[model samples]
Target: MAEHAGAQKGDVICFGHTHKPWHREVEGIHFVNTGSVGRPKDGDWRAGYVILEMSGDQPRVEFVRVEYDLQQVMEAIRQSELPDDFAEYLATGGIPRPVESAADAE
Candidate 1:
């Protein structure tokens, strides 16, 4: 993500691409990631976002996960033309088929 889009020196940079969430300050600017709302991939069941605020001299970051109906997502998946296994994934949170290891080839 592009941080400091026309931002000044004292601006905060927040972005989320990697499923893992993090917050830190480099030099003077604060860098943060809001994390993932779906398929956190961190093995945490919570789906959420992050909220940041400057409290005095330090920046405060909070991650919030709201309860959502997975059934609705599942139903949408079922109704859509997506593969059936997608709904299966939603229902069971099971990992999809694993790719063959290089050792298996040799």
Candidate 2:
């Protein structure tokens, strides 16, 4: 936002790296994060995304969650060389458990 919109008023920014869908306004700037489509980390399962509708002067943001065939996804992964961790992630929407750090090894 700082780079593109420069904190301009009414500026809307969208991103999805966190895979946690959300919509909010901060400092007069609007932000929406369209969560992952194939693998969300919000623990709600199913595919997730956001839909923005500009009906009037204000933009309406809606969070959409769609259900897909989980069995097929698991089967395809099982038949391929993909890591089991990937399949597990698709099966569960929970954020990945943090790994132990070097400090924890001490």
Candidate 3:
């Protein structure tokens, strides 16, 4: 991923599309993924985030998780036209399977 992103040595890259928090250093490049705060898909389920501190020439990364009112979000979803599976996904942190099509089954 770094290769495609043209990341170089000593570069710090931060991204959060996957909703799963992670950090790593590759060939002097630092990569940080600051997971989702509301719709997390990382199974542990609490809101996930990250803190990056730069002291002098060194960088420090900290992952943070916080508790939120899941029931309130679920209730809102229940009242909406969206499918119930959305609420379930928020509770379990597991993505709902895509609905299979008859043509694709072959």
TM-score of each model, paired residue for residue? 0.61, 0.77, 0.77
- Tens-digit lDDT track of model 2 for 7-104: 46556778889888998776556789998888688887698878998776578999999988888997898889998777778876766766899999
> Looking at model 2, which ten-residue stretch has the lowest summed lDDT?
1-10
Candidate 2 deviant stretches above 4 angstroms: 1-6, 96-106
Candidate 3 residues lying further than 4 Å off, grouped into runs, are 2-10, 95-106
Candidate with more favorable, higher TM-score: 1 or 3: 3
Q: For all candidates, what are the clash counts?
A: 0, 0, 0
Q: Indicate the worst ten consecutive residues by lDDT in candidate 1.
A: 1-10
Q: Ranking under lDDT, best-scoring first?
A: 3, 2, 1
Per-candidate local distance difference test: 0.70, 0.79, 0.82
Where model 1 places Cα greater than 4 Å from the true spot, the runs are 1-8, 88-106
- State residue 55's C-alpha deviation in candidate 1, in Å: 1.8
Q: Which predicted model would earn the best lDDT?
A: 3
lDDT of 1 by residue, 5-93 (tens): 33546657888788667877766677888877775645454577898888888889998876678788878888999986666664443
